[model samples]
Target chain A: MSINLTILGCHSATPRANAFPTAQYLEINNRHFLIDCGEGTQRQMRKYKVGFTKINHIFISHLHGDHFYGLIGLLSTYGILSREKELHIFGPKGIKEVTLLQLKISQSHAKYPLIFHELTSKESELIFEDDKVTVRTIPLKHRVYTNGYLFTEKEKPKKLHIDNINHYEEIDRADYNNIKAGKDIVLSTGEIVPNSELTLPPKKPLSYAFCSDTCYKPDIIPIIKNADLLYHEATFLADKTDLAKKTKHATTKEAALIAKEATVNKLIIGHYSGRYKDITLFKDEAQEIFKNTKLAEPGKVFKII
Target chain B: MSINLTILGCHSATPRANAFPTAQYLEINNRHFLIDCGEGTQRQMRKYKVGFTKINHIFISHLHGDHFYGLIGLLSTYGILSREKELHIFGPKGIKEVTLLQLKISQSHAKYPLIFHELTSKESELIFEDDKVTVRTIPLKHRVYTNGYLFTEKEKPKKLHIDNINHYEEIDRADYNNIKAGKDIVLSTGEIVPNSELTLPPKKPLSYAFCSDTCYKPDIIPIIKNADLLYHEATFLADKTDLAKKTKHATTKEAALIAKEATVNKLIIGHYSGRYKDITLFKDEAQEIFKNTKLAEPGKVFKII
Candidate 1:
């Protein structure tokens, strides 16, 4: 019933002494998902105490080395650990071939089913749905084919009004299920107690959107509108706006602009360039545009409410 | 001249919290070479303070994930760092295609030239040679095509006998180079001083051999014979001899036997199975056959005499 995120690594392309590349672990509705596994992600997972076996689905934004180089090592470790649970991987086209080729050359065959779901759509589309949450792909513009993911919690059942239910002596204990399901209870006296009188409306469902390694594009605002939380990559500060545009990456101002225009409740910025040792400038610049902006540091956890 | 080896990573297969996979850095004859770059090798290099730009030649024994999964990440880091030096990579066949395919898929073109030398021969052949050192392949028995490398220091110039030079004042200082080259020196009095009397023999050229992930193959003894140091993979103890044979891995006893038969000055055993947490047992088992056996631990350095 809660959405939690753990930042395994947040630095850009190369992993250095204390800075790691991009990797995040999201836990929502009792399920865990790994997003953008860069090199040393497994070590980061271990360092953060994220359960490696709990990661069943992996979502990759693109085929960049900083995003997907750790994939083979992770898979190899799973094989070495003799993991039997099926693992689902979703990414752009050519990921499957690239993964399989590495495995073939390394002579490593995974004991678990490494199911891959290739994404190639240019528009926002639902990619996964379950009873607790729904996942959709937010097509992104980058140097390569990329995708950002939108995770939204499903509507929860109404909260039971204990005092109202206690007043209904005619309602059996077995009828509680029906009351929680938004149904009225029928009494033996032929009187109907409205469900609204016995139960209160559930809280608003929360949603989180992840966007990384993309240029400034207002087209994604509609797809991620009204999200409870949004994570965007800000590789450079405002001064490097031209460099960001040339590299097809976003600046802090651009990321904040997207978050502000989309009306997200809170925004988290990460994927800082290694050249910038101090990240306070990024947060300061981003906050100028979106006051709710936060820096995504490694091992930092955020709750989406 | 001296041959120094730094063990960057020594564990086998999967990288763990403190135990990394196989990677070793060798500084021989004023040249740096990286052997078996496993996952997190760049981080290990940083941790051990090994100069990154000094490594120009990389030798990979096989395509196993534990051996070469870190290559792409390292190459990407080099690109990000704007390294313009050409890197020479030597590995088994299919390495070039695999490396290039990953680069193509990731869209990470190296700024430096990544020249590849695909090795397919199974016989003991000279793979590389320079004025300082000569490298040859030691055919090994493994699950796939594998080769162990032998690095031998080329013969050095004889050391001038300082005291003897002072006695022969008539021998011009310019003739010192000729004396060091093992030529007889003639004084102004026409007295011939034999090369042995004028100059001492050059310190015996040192050599080191690396054999890993292979079974007990006696044929490699001749190639590694009289090596100053030999690093052989001892994946299991004597108790797991059956498993070693089945998996085509060598046991501690087998590695010791090979070292003893090859007459190596020192034997370093590594690539331990994760099951054995305490590696002292491997050293003990190896020392029973070869007295000069040593354990290869992360960050451990071995000096070859």
Candidate 2:
């Protein structure tokens, strides 16, 4: 299964006319998951036609307005629609306070259950485990308590060539099972059916990691290494290395360094500072270290195979 | 002078697709004032080109999410824009708690000073006084402590007919004022300049009263009666009057009763429930009782002449 990522917003602290705040929609095995929810995200979802009902989990990296300002609006809307299914939100400790306060002040009694899973540690650990994927936190170096999420799709079942194997075709259930298990099948009547002739391999599971608004630390290299798709924050250009260090933000070169050291299949760098009018500098800087580098633009979609 | 009102959003409980919650842009003279802030207001402002900088004063009708969900985003954007002018906000006591906390957590300090005028009473008292207008609170009937805003534009200065004045007129400033005030004028040259010939009567100031998410209360009629434009909450249709009363929200028919009894020049009914997909029923129901009823549709402007 391949993972498709859509960038809803890719701006830093300040929201610009061209670039919005940080938010992305990741679709794996036809299931939709939201990464971050910036302000005006509902409108973005509407514009993109991403069905909100399909989204079951939202992973928030931090408490910055640019990161999760649109969360309350979305939550209240879910209540207004009288949703019955539980909405799962995974974030830091203070997230529940902010979310609960908004709901309480609105006098909104939700018809659906709201489940919150708070991440407390700065280490690699599973925050969510589901039938299709597992989400783990990757410790990130930022000004405040923050963690990036790693979504890894579960292993799919073995494939069977139904078009070739039929009930009347002498291939029994045991023979089909042997073919599905990648073994040579010998029928009861001394007929042979090779595994390669009856079945193909199941698609490989895909994984995507989101690391933003953080300094490039080598410690996360092992955790995110060989990820199918890795998005890292490149808030500044190479010339502003000093400013990046002072602000604890990553420069393009540093983000590129992480992608290179981790050997990620695809590197997408974004969360650009508004000071740089031309974002091509970040693209140029990151491309120096990583060959498959792309600048994350708002509303752009990328596929990881 | 005429008062112009634009319905930016008009839904009560929460934001819905195409039916935004309580947010409106009111304009009198050269000023623009935001009455309420529903979610996605900045996007609505951008779509309508209602310059955010021109919004000097924001009057929040209540602390409900439908009324104030977009306040922090607007304020945050103002901070990012480095607005130097002071922003005067009028709202309930919890408003400061809502805004200040978000700013604190996000570490976003505004470059401009935010002056919050907390409304904490049920009396018809003067809340905001400016050069061109004076604002008073009309205590409303709602589940929470909600108050409606009465924006009354100051009376215009009478025009003086300079060409009609005598060349040898040696009238003092007080005499000119008296003449402008419709008093008889006697010139120094033994000539009489009648007030009728010297000046025209000042036009009456136009007023717009915003009755936020509240039920029909006849007591407020004395304060908002005969307003140039009156916006009342019509959260439900005539069929759901019981639900409306139970929720402390006004039905379309109920809102029209108040508008008709108050003898308002023009009535705009809004704060619609998301249940009704079409809003024409609300206008028809209100117009059945009040002839001059109008629906507050998004991006539509209603002028008070």
Please name the candidate that would achieve the greatest lDDT relative to the true structure: 1
Using Cα atoms, each model's DockQ against the true complex is 0.66, 0.30
User: What TM-score would candidate 1 get against the native?
Assistant: 0.93
Candidate 2 runs further than 4 Å off = A12-20, A29-32, A109-111, A156-203, A215-219, A234-257, A272-305, B12-17, B172-197
lDDT, residue B49, candidate 1: 88
lDDT of 2 by residue, B200-291 (tens): 66888888899987887999999998988899999999889899889899998889999888999889998888778888999999999999
Tens digits of per-residue lDDT for model 1, B93-127: 98898899988898888879999999999898998
Winning model by DockQ: 1
Q: Evaluated against the true chain A, what TM-score does chain A of model 1 have?
A: 0.96
Q: Report residue B37 deviation for candidate 1 (angstroms).
A: 0.8
Please provide TM-scores, in order, for all candidate models, with all chains considered together: 0.93, 0.84
